[model samples]
Target: MKAYRMLTEDEVLQLKSQSCLADDWNNVLVSSDFNTAYVHHTRFSGNVKLGSFDGEFTLKGGIKKHAGLRHVTLHNVTVGDCCCIENIQNYIANYEIGDHTFIENVDIILVDGLSKFGNGVEVAVLNETGGREVLINDKLSAHQAYILALYRHRPELINRIKEITDFYSNKHASDKGAIGSHVMIVNTGSIKNVRIGDYCYIEGTCRLKNGSINSNADAPVHIGYGVICEDFIISSGSHVDDGTMLSRCFVGQACQLGHNYSASDSLFFSNCQGENGEACAIFAGPFTVTHHKSTLLIAGMFSFMNAGSGSNQSNHMYKLGPIHQGTLERGAKTTSDSYILWPARVGAFSLVMGRHVNHADTSNLPFSYLIEQGNTTYLVPGVNLRSVGTIRDAQKWPKRDKRKDPNKLDYINYNLLSPYTIQKMFKGREILKELKRVSGETSEIYSFQSAKIKNSSLNKGIGFYEIAIQKFLGNSIIKRLEGVDFKSCEEIRARLKPDTEIGLGEWVDVSGLIAPKSEVDKLLDGIENGDINRLDEMNTSFETMHQNYYTYEWTWAYNKIQEFYKLNSDEITVQDIINIVNQWKEAVIGLDKMVYADAKKEFSLSSMTGFGADGSREEKEQDFEQVRGVFESNPFVTAVLKHIDDKTVLGNELINRIGHLA
Candidate 1:
C-alpha cells in the first residue's frame, strides 16, 4: 500500500506556480516523496492519488524524460510511481495506472460504471445464426471453445460451461480498469473500460472498448497503428495491428491479425494468423492461417488449416437465414478460388481443389483429395499420406508455434499418424472394401456420400491406408519392445501387451488434442455431473490426457494389431514379430519412395518453364537448379532418404534382437 499524504501548503503553491491546477488542493493526495518540481501544466479533479515521480526514462537516441504528470487531467485515478502521463486530450477517469507506464496523447481513457472488461461477452462462433456462443474470457482455450461450440446437443454441458465462465467473469468484474507496469499507450483514441496488461505496447490504436489484453512481461502484446478492438480478449504474445478490426472476439496466444483483417464474433485459438481477409463467426483452432485478400472465412470450424487466395464458403442456400456451418478437420487446405457449400465436413489433411455444391461428408476418409469436375465432386482417398506438401505441412506446424508464454492455453498434438487419423483410415479402408464388394470388383466407379471414387483410386486408397496402419502399429510395437532383451516367446508376447485399456474403441481430435473418445466422454460426463466446474481443472484434465497420449495410443494400437494381423497375443511367436517388422520396413520404404517421387515433380521439366525466362532449355535447367536445388539434394528429399536408411537399420536391429528369442 502506498503512503499517501496531503500536499503541503508550500508544495501546492509551487505546483500552482508551475501552472498545475486542481479543483481543490485537498482532493489530491500525493505520495510522501512526491515532488512539485516535476508537476507542470496538469489539472487534477475528483479524488486523485499521485505516486512519487523520482525515476527518469531513457528513450531511443539517448534522450531522457523525467517521470511526472504533465498537460493531463486525472479524475478519481491513482497514478503509480515513476509513470509519465502527458498531453491527455481528455480526462482519464477511474483508472489505476501502474509504475513505469507511459501514457501520452491519449484521448478519453475512462471506465464508465462497472465493467467486466469484455468478460461474459458471448461471441457467436462456428455457427453464425446465434446458437453457438462462446463466452469471451481471459482463460478461454481452444478445447473449451470446441466443446462450447460443438456440444450443443448436450444442453447441460453448455449451461455448465456458461456458468463456469459467468462465475469467472463476475469474479473479475471491477469498477475501475487498470493499466499495468511498463505499458505504453501513445496516440490512441478512446480506450474505454479496457484492462491493459504489463509490457503491452499500444500505439496509434483507435477505439478499444471493453477488452482485456492479457499481456505479460514474459510475452508482451503489441497493438499497433489503426487497430480497433471491441468486446475482445487478446491473450499473451499476440499482435493485432495495421488497421485490424475485431468485434466480440477471443484471440488466443501468439495469434496475429493484421493488414486490415476484419473479424466479427470469431474465436481464434493459439497461433492463428489472419491477414487481409475477413472472418465472421468462425472457430479457428490452432494454426489456422488465412493470408489472402477477398478470402472470407465464415460460419466454419477449422484447425491446422490454410486457406488459399479467394477461397470461400457459403452458409446459406437463400432458403432461410445463414444457419449452416461446416468443419474442415485438422491439416485441411483449400486451393485458390475453391468454394464449398456449407453443411459439409472435409476430412483431416484433405485437399479441396474446386467448387463443390454438394454437401459431401468425407470425415471417414482422411488424407484425401476432393476435386470437382463438371460440378461433380470426386474423392481420392489416402493420397495425401504420400504428398511431399502434406509431410512438410505436418513438419512445419510444431516449428511454427509462436506461443512464448509459459502458461500456454492450447494442447497441440503435431503427429500426423495418431490414433485420430488412423481410426479414420481404418473406416476409409472398410468403406472402400464395402464399395468393392457391393458394386462388383469390375465396376469403373463407386458412389459414396454424394461423391464418386474410381475403382483404381479405391484400390490405391486401400493400399495407402494399409501402409499407414502398418507404419503406426509397427511403430507402437517397436517402441513397446524398444529396450527389452527378450530371451523367449513368452517375454515377447508379454511385452507386446498394452499397458492400459484406455484407448480401446474410437479416438477424436478435439481441436488439436488427440485422445481416445472414451476419455473425452469421461471428461464430458464429469462436466455434466458438475464435478469439473473450474476452467483450470478442465485444462488440467486436458494436460493429463496430453501427457498420457503415448500410453493410450499403445492401447489402441495393440487392439488394432490383433484385428489387422489376426494374431492372438498369447500364441504369437518371434516369426510373427519378424513378419510384422518386415511389413513395417516395406511400408516405410514404400512411403518414402512415394514422397521422393512426389518431391521430384518440383524439379520436373514442366515445373521449370518459368524458371529461366528468355533462355534456352539448358540455361533454364541451370537456372532451375540454381533456384531450386536438385531433387536428390533437396532437403526434404534427403530427409526422406535418410528416413528410409534409418528405418531399415531399425527393422534389422529389431529382427536381430527378436531372432534370439526363437
Candidate 2:
C-alpha cells in the first residue's frame, strides 16, 4: 500500500499542458515521486489513485515502452507503480491495477455492481437437467465434483456442500475487481466483473465476463487468441486459447482447451485436454482428453479417458429431457467414429468401438472390449489386460501430469491396478462364471445386459480375469512379505496382516483417487453431519486418502486374500507361500508375453504397408524399420521383457527365502 498525496496546483497545470484531464484535480491522488512527463493524454474521472511511473518494459522483439498512462480513461481506478495503461476503447472502472502490469488495446476492464468472479457457478455436470449441478469454485477438485454430481440422492449432503461453496464464494465477492501485479492484457476485448491474477497473460481474448483467472507466478495462466470465457474459473497452470469458448465451466489446474473447442456447463479437472471438440454437461475428470473436431462428449462422466475422432454420445430419448448420462470409468477409450447412446457404463480400461444403443453396463467387467457387430454390442471381457496400449496408457498418465503449481488442487492416483479394478475383476470373474452356468456351457452366445458375449470370448474372459486376480493377490502377498524373513507360519500370518483397518468391503474409484467405498462414505457422513465444514477440509481429507492409498489398499487386499487364495490365516504354511509364488510367476510372465505379442502386431508386415511410398520390398522394410523401429527393440517390448525377468527373479527370491520354513 503505497502512500499517495494530492497533486499540487503546479503539477495539475503541467498535467493540463500534457493533454491529461481530470474531472476534479482534487479527486486525483498520485504517489509522491510521480512524474508528470509519463502521464500523457490520459483522462481521469471519479476518485482515482496513481502510482509513480519510473521504469520501462522491454518486450518481445526488442520493443521498448516506458511505463506510463496514455490514451486511457480511468474511473475510480487505482494504478500501481511502474504500470502502463493505454489504448482502451472503453474506460477501466473500479479496478485496482497492480504494479508493473501492462494493459493495451483492451476494450474495457471493469466491475459492475457486486460479483464473485465465477465462483459458485453451477456447472450442470453429467446430467443435462439442472439437478446434478456442481458449484464450481477455485478449489474444486475432481473428487469433490464427483460427489456433488453423483451423490444427488443425499439432499442434505448436497445442500451442506453447496452452502459451503456459496459461503466461500460470498467471502470473495467484491464490488471492485483486481488485476494482479506483472500481468499483461494485450489486444483483448472486454473483461467485466473479472479478477485477473498475478503474472497472467491475456492476448486476443474476445470476451471474459464474470470469471476468475486464478493465475500466479508459480504457474501463470495463459489466455490466447480468440478465447471467450464466461462464468468460469481457470485455475493455475492452465492454458485456454485458439478460439476456445467456455460457459459455466471450471477449468482445473494444468488443463488445455483450445483449437476451437467449445464447452458448456462442464467441469474439467486436472490435466484434461479438449481440442477441436465440444463438451456439454460433462464431468471430465483427471487426464480426460478429446482431440478431434467431430467429437461431442455430452452428459457423461469420464476420467483417465480418451475420445477418438468423431466419437459421440446421445442422452435424449426425445420423450423426457436429456436426463440420461453415462460413465466411461477411469482409463476408458473410444475408437474413431464410435458412438454410444447414454445411460450405459463402460468398465475401467475398456475399449469402445463402433455404434451401440444397447446400453450395456460393463462396469463390473474391467479391461474389456465393447465391439458392435450388425448393431449388436459384443462384450469381450478382460481382453484389454494384455493390450500393449493399455500398459502404455497406464505408464504414461503419471509421466504426463502437467500440473506445475506447487499447491496442487487435485490429488491424482495413476495406478492402473489398484484394489478398485482388481475388485471389479473379482466380481467380473463371478459374473462370467454365472453367465456360463445359467447359459449352457455349449451355448454359442450368452446374452447379458442387452449385449451378446460369444462362448469363446466368455471363457477367455473368465480365464483372463482369473489370471489377473491371481496376479493381484500374488503381488499383494509378495509386497506384504517383501523385506521380511519369516521363520514360521505364525510369523508369516502376522506379517501378512493389513497395516490399516479402513479398506474393507467395496472399493471405488472416486474420479482418480481409488479408495474403499466405506472410507468415502465416512467422508460423506462427515460432510452431512457438519464435521467437515470447509472446502480445504474436504481437500485435506482427499489428500489424506491419496497419501495413505497403499496402506488402505493393503487392507483391502488382505481381506480378499482369504476369499481368493482360500487361505486360512491361522494355519497358513510356507508351502502355501511357495504355491502362490509359483502361480504369481506364471501369471506375471504369461501376461507379459501376451503384451509382447500384442506389441509385435504393430510392427508386422501388414502394419508397414504404407511406410515406403515408392520402394521395393527391402526398401519398404528398411523405411518401416526406420520409422517404427523393430518390434524387439521397441521401448515397450523391452520394458515388458524386463518386467518378465524382474518378476521371475522376484518370485524365485521370495520362494528361496521362505523355503527355509518348510
TM-score of each: 0.98, 0.98
Q: Please, what are the lDDT tens digits per residue for candidate 2 over residues 473-519?
A: 88988988988877787888888878779988888888888878888
> Model 1: residues >4 Å from true position, as ranges?
60-62
Instruction: List model 1 lDDT by residue over 1-662, tens digit each.
Output: 76899999999999999998999999999998898888899998899999989888887699889999899998989999999989999889999999999988889999999999999999988777799999988988898888888889999999999999999999999989999999998899999999999999999999899999999999999999999999999999999999999999999999999999999999999999999999999999999999999899999999999999999999999999799999999999999999999989999999999998999999999999999999999999999999999999989999999888999999999999999999999999999999999998999989998999999999999999999999998988888888878788887888888888899899989999999989888998999998998999999999999999999999999889989999887898898889999999999999989999999888899999898888899999999999988888888888999999999999999999889766
Relative to the true structure, how large is the alpha-carbon lDDT of every model? 0.93, 0.92
TM-score between model 1 and native = 0.98
Best by lDDT: 1
Cα lDDT, model 1, residue 60: 60
Clashing pairs in 2: none
lDDT at residue 636 of model 1 (Cα atoms): 85
